[model samples]
Target: MASSLLIMQARLASSRLAQKALLPIYAGKPSLLYAMQGVYGVADAHVLACDVASFSSFEPIAQEAGFAIMAGDADDVLARFAHVAKEYKVDYVIRATADNLIVGQELVRLALDGAIDSDADYFCFEATAHGSGVEVIRRTVLLDAYANASSPFEREHVTPYIYGHPQRYKVIKPVVESRFFAPDLRSTLDTPEDYTRLVEFFTHRAFPSQTIIEEYIAWMRSNLYQMSL
Candidate 1:
């Protein structure tokens, strides 16, 4: 079995919602803790990758969730991932973002399994809900991006350089079940509106870390329907 690592990229700095990671989600737990919990056990190792400024603030949360912390460049997130990938010598990496609060272990496993079976350089689910998904990529492919990715967007987003150049890299997109294919639904926390929506929907609910992907989708769709009323 190829060694796999789940890297959750996070930072305290945000243009839209400041310190959103530290904001309470459910049961007074911050979003980062739940995000880390969501991907637990699916990978051989779990790590929280962030910048220097975020390391101190996130350390306690990461520790509480049993995730190792790695700090690097603030803007070059790809470099941070490369450093972690090389240090751990993992064969495959599951890329996750802290903003995606509803990411689940099932989806991570699916992406990892698909990547291994197809030998995909980059793998992701097609038309899946935004925040519930993660990207799986080969270690060599990620290193390639770290070494050659010149554009700031590519470095910041990570894996974009690989997926952007299909000719040079193999990209895989497996279609999800009809229920999981929710392109219009938005679950990511990038703004004040996003945070308010998340808090309103999840604060009174079950442990979001334990909530399955299906439930998240259902809630979002129902909320959207109610909003349309």
Candidate 2:
């Protein structure tokens, strides 16, 4: 079976922060560029699809970055996702958000690897609605999600209908061994403070290839000489 991933993303159209993706972190690069590079570091067979009303700005950026861009309905995200997944005929699907500047590659790969071992219908790293890291789905599971869910929440958001109604399918959450922590390390891009923290991290090292906690801890410990305080 062909294991593939599709990154569901769009430009900064959110009410919280306008044009967050295009916001510059450091080294004259946008947050979305770092995100794309981070994702590219982990999996190879993946594409980014952004729901822009017109192919005016983001299209060029995605094209230049070597990603396949598609203009589709912004509201009905599940329908868009289902259409793309079916067209690709992917056995496994990886769901990534553009806001996660501190997205974990090793964690994602680890979770995906574990999901394949179990009989779970859905694989996710975090369980809660706030910290939902990422999700991986078997084609069968995704098809079920699309087929069964048809509500306002599902239509606006992508996977909540399936995830919210857990009794319908078996969901998997993978584990990793680690120690040490901090009070808060901004992971996703939403407000200016989050962007500032990311800028602080990026100042140390431009577009790190490591996960959030690892990179933050490394920056704190000064283990990585390439990054400067």
Candidate 3:
């Protein structure tokens, strides 16, 4: 079995929502904790990747969650990911973001399995209702992207180089079959409204990320129907 690593990239600094990861989501627990919890047992190892300046701020949180931390260039997120992937000797990597709290184990597993079964260089969900999703890529493919990708967009947003260059890499966007397929629903915490909605979500009794997502979808559909009526 090829070793896979799940890397959650996060930072305290944010132009839209500063320190959003530290925001209390469930009973005073930080949003990062919940994000970390969502992917437990889905990877051989898990690491929280952040910049050096923000390392101290995130170290305690990572420690609390039993996750390792890797600090790298603040703007070069792809470099950070590549470094971690190389250091861990991981054959595959599942990329995630901290503000995306709904990236549950199921989604991670789906991406990983799709990449392995299809022999794809990169794999991701086609249309996710939530901002939560996983990107699975081989370490060699990531290293190649890091080396040849010139655009800041490609470096900062990782995996774009691979997907953008279809001739060089085989990409797969797996369709996620679910009753709750609300692609319009925003699950990422990038704005005040997103934070407020997430707070409301966490206030309810805790459940797995998948269940929370399903419930949210159901609620959204019903609310839309009522509004139309």
TM-score, cand. 1 vs. native: 0.94
Order by TM-score, highest first: 1, 3, 2
**Candidate 3 residues 161-199, lDDT tens each?**
999998889988866776535576777888877888778
Residue 36 lDDT in candidate 3 = 82
The lDDT values for all models are 0.86, 0.64, 0.82
| TM, every model | 0.94, 0.82, 0.93
Candidate 1 weakest lDDT stretch, 10 residues: 220-229
User: Cα deviation in Å at residue 73, candidate 3?
Assistant: 0.6
Ten-residue segment with the worst summed lDDT in candidate 2?
177-186
Q: Could you tell which candidate, 1 or 2, scores higher by lDDT? A: 1
Which candidate achieves the best TM-score against the true structure?
Answer: 1
Tens digits of per-residue lDDT for model 2, 42-101: 544555656765346676666655666666677777766776677676667777777775
lDDT of 1: 0.86
Which portions of model 3 show Cα errors greater than 4 Å? 207-210, 223-229
Model 3 sits at a Cα RMSD from the real structure of: 2.7
Q: Model 1 Cα displacement at 192 (Å)? A: 1.4
